[model samples]
Target: MRDSFDPSASEIETTTAEEGKTRKRPRPGERRLQILQVLAEMLQNPKGERVTTAALAAKIQVSEAALYRHFASKAQMFEGLISFIEQTVFGLINQINQKEESGLAQARGILQMLLFFAEKNPGMTRVLLGDALLQEDDRLQERITQVLDRVETSLKQALRIAQTQGGTWANVSQDEVSIRAAMLMSYVLGRWHRFARSGFKKLPTEASDISLRILLSE
Candidate 1:
């Protein structure tokens, strides 16, 4: 029955975490977003040269120590980029799930989104393909692998439905449908990689309807 119950132990703990202690200020979630924005910008480079903390700091117009204030290490920054990639790509995939009536249409939408995402974010394409993550850390590459798996899984789901409807593909097993989905994903990645390597010149989906038909057929 004190003035404020002596600010209980839990309250004090929460206060310390919120306000920070001796090491450094807590990294705001928004700061993580900013760090990723900068990282994606770096990836747009065609040469895909190594991205150093110093260079990132310069691009962001902040000191390297400032970058560390939000991320523990440079590798964590790449992880941040991967997190954004997952959130964004999957969010679109979910929307297609809810919106599309035809499996073929959903498949088309997913491919369109993938290539369009690359076209919109040139720098992000480099990082997405691991041209930038190549020597940085193994974790970054693993994250990319997981991203591809999710996309492939979504594709298989849609294509399996398409086969059930007996359209372009008919009576496909999960295994065969899964293989076709993976192949489509591989095609998209190849297109994206070429776009990133060409410095965003070559597009992956200009005449994609015809190309997608070829993929859907074979």
Candidate 2:
């Protein structure tokens, strides 16, 4: 993936019928995406403060009222970012599960992909760590909890399959697999938290391969 996130032209057109004089106006639904992209970019700042609608509007050269046109409230805007994270990560996870034959390998790849994604998208890492969601609606944090649960479920499935295939942990029961999956989630969360708290200086992937080898080894 590209180092920074940018919306494709097809995804966001510059001209709309409302903005006359043939000037480029944001297309339908494009403004919402532009808003979300700008929000992500602002969150990338390691020392960034709690984002306000006024600041976000200033960044995009729009009035706060204009921002309200696309989203009912700032929390809704954040929900958009969280939704993107869920879709992107889970879609990639599905691919990993489908393509990889070795269950342990699938689990490993999912963890690596999580780190790699955070490394590329520093702003999103803030969201993953709950730094950006501070003081937001309680439900936003709940949504993150759900996302983590889904990740754990995926890990558990891969591990159970691995045991059945006699790759590793062949003698383990479902309960053990569940415990290991929880451990994997904890590992991922810890790495993400460190990355965010260190001003994005400490990478999630630092020493990750060796660590995962030890964690996944039987």
Q: For model 2, what is the alpha-carbon lDDT of residue 24?
A: 68
Tens-digit lDDT track for model 1 on 5-104?
1112212122346657533333445555666766776776777788899998997677999899888998988887777678888888888878998888
* lDDT of model 1 at position 86: 80
lDDT of 2 by residue, 1-218 (tens): 33345757324333546655344676787788889999998998888589888999999888999999999999999999998898899989988888899899999999999999999888988887788999999899989888888989999999988998974489888899999999998999899888887888999999999999999998
Clashing pairs in 1: 44-123
After superposition, candidate 1 runs with Cα above 4 Å error? 1-30
Per-model TM-score on C-alpha atoms: 0.82, 0.90
Q: TM-score for model 2?
A: 0.90
Question: What's the distance in Å from true for residue 109, model 1?
Answer: 0.9
lDDT of 2: 0.87
